[model samples]
Target chain A: GQQVMQIPQYQHVQEGEDFTTYCNSSTTLSNIQWYKQRPGGHPVFLIQLVKSGEVKKQKRLTFQFGEAKKNSSLHITATQTTDVGTYFCKGGSEKLVFGKGTKLTVNP
Target chain B: GAGVSQSPSNKVTEKGKDVELRCDPISGHTALYWYRQSLGQGLEFLIYFQGNSAPDKSGLPSDRFSAERTGGSVSTLTIQRTQQEDSAVYLCASSRWTGEKAFFGQGTRLTVV
Candidate 1:
């Protein structure tokens, strides 16, 4: 069985602070996808990384894929109250095995 | 369709009853997936349907859970002898055969008593 584990199950930060969540897989992954779920909303795809040691950025958000393809990270710089949500990393096989997710809470 | 659609936004049933959740994926998509999310928990893979090929039921927690996709257009997830543990938000998503980003529906929230 394949498994993707995430750290910092919960994170709370004040507006203008930074937040980061890490994900690790038990086995190598062909690719990894990140998603965000708003309070009481379904998960929305944010980004996907395929190449090893790849880093992609979206404004204040930065995504990184490990060189081994077994780990990934999502970092938010200068967070805002609107950034409150759970971030998930999905991998393993092609069935979308998702990690437990890291829930982010921001206070203004 | 513009996006995935699921029926019965919420469901409440007594123990030992049966319930079925429906999912309609975006047109022209060939990959459909079902997952369960308990309170404060992550996505729990239930099954995967790819085109007309055999489905992957490896993530199903028990035999009571089953799903089917008709004409590769719509899917239904059925649960028998529902238990309290079955109370969770069941989510459905669809993607192209290339396995790109998946578009999800609002999901059906089931609460079994």
Candidate 2:
């Protein structure tokens, strides 16, 4: 079975601080997708990275896929209170295998 | 449907009871997935359906859990002899295919007493 592991299971930071969560997969992934879930809400799609050593940015967030396609990272610059949520990464070929997720708490 | 729809946004059942959770994926979508999230926990993959091929049930935690997709559009997850630990939010998602961005439903929160 394929597995995706995320680091820093929980994180707390002051507003404007930067935060990063790392994800590693037990097997090489054809693609990786990022999702965010707000408190008391369902997960929502954020971004997807496929090519080797690929980097994509969405405003304050930057996502990077490893050259080997075995790992990925999500970096949030100058985090805001709205960024407080759990971030998940899914990786695999046939069925997406989700990582344990990184919970980010931003305090004002 | 416009998005993934799950039935009975919330449910309460007693231990040893059987419960069924339903999910309707977006029209024309080819991939559907089921995930469970306990309080303050991450998404736990339960099963997956892709087109007409055999479903992937490797993520199911126990034999007590089973799911079926009929007409490749709607899915139902059944948990028999439920336990207190079965209390969690069951989420369903659909995508164009494997590895694609997925859209998730609001999820059904199950409480086992």
Clashes (backbone N, CA, C under 3 Å), per candidate, total 0, 0
Please list the residue runs of candidate 2 whose C-alpha ends up more than 4 Å from where it truly belongs after superposition.
Answer: none
Over A1-108, each residue of candidate 1 has an lDDT whose tens digit, in order, gives 467889999999999999999999878988888999999999999999999999999999999999999999999999999899999998754777788999999999
Over 4 Å off, model 1: none
TM-score of chain A of each: 0.96, 0.96
Q: What lDDT tens digits, residue by residue, belong to model 1 across residues B52-91?
A: 9999999999999999999999999999999999999999
Error of 1 at A70 (Å): 2.0
Model 1, position B60: C-alpha lDDT score: 96
RMSD of candidate 1 to true structure, Å: 1.3
Please state the error at residue A94 of candidate 2 in Å. 2.5
